[model samples]
Target: MLGGLWEWWRRRRLLVDASFAAPLLLLAVFYQGELDQGIYGFPGVGFLGYWALHAGLLLPLVWRRRWPRATFAIIALACFGQWLLHVPLMAGDVAVLYGLYTVTAYCSFRWSLAAVLVTLLGAVLEAAQLANLPREFRWAVMFLSAVCVGVWLLGLHMRTRRAYLRSLEERAERLERERGNELQVARAAERARIARELHDVVAHNVSVIVVQADGAAFTLDTDPDRARKALETISETGRTALAEMRRLVGVLRENAHESGDGYAPQPGVEQLAELVDQMHRSGLPVTLTVDGTPIEVSEGRQLTIFRVVQEALTNTLKHGGPRAAARVTVRYAPDAIEVRVSDDGRGAAAPDDGRGHGLVGMRERVAVYGGRVRAAPRPGGGFEVIARIPVREEART
Candidate 1:
């Protein structure tokens, strides 16, 4: 029951009505004589009469938090009227200190200061009249001024502390949001890398197997030896593709453990020979050329070049005619590496445009390492794909 009452006092509209009503309740319960002494002043009206007067004056205080200036004015007027009527001195008027503090914390600085000065001046004069001290009684007026001033300064400090706390909370919340965004960006980049690997592995290797298997079936009756060779090539190419794919995908598993020493090494340009052999055995006439000494490149750039070549060959097998032949050339330079893949096919002679996942994967790969790729029909004939990857002077590939 007491908890409920306390909650109501803290939250209800009755707080305004009961701000002074509470004191009146106490006065009625405790005060017995018409004129008496208690915790409050005496020698005039009894404690009950003085409390009644203060409660009536505080009727306006219910609105203090809402209308501070009006409440202050009302309280000041009540006190001045009591002095005029010669009512016994009452300490209940001390509630003005709290009301003044609220006004100082919420109102403009100048207005709050002016209100404090006016109230202190009135309090000093009232105290001097009510309590007749020795000749040094004037010193009491100064003491009253000091007490009111101290209360006003306390209110200012509380307001400053509250504002400081609010600023710190806002800074912490902003930092949390920034950290979340950075994590999301990192996740999105890793996912795109995985997708490119998947397309290169599945599409390129699968296309080669299909072509080789078809040739083996066609030659089984007429040429048993050639048929066996085609079947063998299909088996070898499929296994190599699966191995490469496993290496790339292992990083994606949540609990995947790296080698005790470090991460696995990535495949680079040296692996192109094995790739070309797979296409030759699939019955596509392919030419391979390397101009300068092979040099090392970053894992990301190496994988990108490898996938571009793989996709180009896959497209040739899928779209090139029966007699189509492909030529692949890798040229190393002082500051960059150039890769070219072209096929003398009679089918739609345009190199893979940005259409199927094959072409899309190639483009995404090239873009990641700051490389440029151009796929178009060769001016003479057939389709051609050209890629140039810029490298640091000290870097090699």
Candidate 2:
């Protein structure tokens, strides 16, 4: 609280300068008679002139901070005029040092240097007026000169300190902005990861349940056994989805390590056969074919490949007609892996609301590996999904 008020007071520069000049103005009025009398016989414009000179010296100080060079020039001219007329120095003459300090603090180094030379010259010339008091003149002038130089030095120090503080404040603000941006980026990345997981879990499993339920409804009166099988598939798919939902909730609620791999390892090449078999049970015909020697890759890259294939096949099962068939092909190369899923169905003619994010999610996953995905309706009355993910040497399992 005190610091805040102190800063507030500093910002009221004009008010502060006025307060500084108040005491000097009072001294110039009441204390001029206390100094030694002038040498000239002529009073030189009488009492009003003295008051005017005193006001001129002090009043300009109110603008010292805003107009340092001008303020100092006006005050210095009045002080020199008073000295040339042999008006013995008064108490308010201290404003001369204050003006020099302002010039040093706010003006360029050149102006500050000139101010110091002028002040030192005035001090020597004033001391010479008291040449009869030789013992005190030298010391008094030396002391005055030292005070003037010291005040100038103090002003320079103040300028340097203010500049340093400003630099620190600027740096702090920059870091705060950068930190906020980084947090936004991290949150966006996390949201994307959660989105991909939800798509994989909910879309594929719910579609299976939906397909099986439809099948059971159609076969209920015609074939009891087929209906029973369809109902069982629906039940199984629902339970699997429920289990996955629980796992996702647990991962969100606890630390990843605390969950103890509760995220559940995602299916990769080893599970493709099972995926094919599962599709068969769902009444979709899919053929899985692998080309080139299988290369071991990290779980993350494997998961990427798996999601691409999973999204493609799920899309196929949902869109492909009862008689449509899909072919799954996995090709491996020295530097990359490709998964191609194509279905001979209604192709782009399939009824879609255009709200699906399956293909977009697949593209995002593949792009993270500096890869690409092409999902389009094939020319020959079919739809195709092709994903290629890079396999860096360091990605070996």
Predicted structure 2: lDDT: 0.77
lDDT of candidate model 1 versus the reference: 0.70
Candidate 1 has a TM-score of 0.45
> lDDT of each prediction vs. the true structure?
0.70, 0.77
Which candidate ranks first by TM-score, i.e. highest? 2
Tens-digit per-residue lDDT, 27-70, candidate 1 = 54454333344453454455555666676565666777778777
TM-score of 2: 0.51
Candidate 1 clashing pairs, residues 3+ apart or interchain: none
Please give each candidate's TM-score: 0.45, 0.51
Return model 2's CA RMSD, one decimal.
19.6
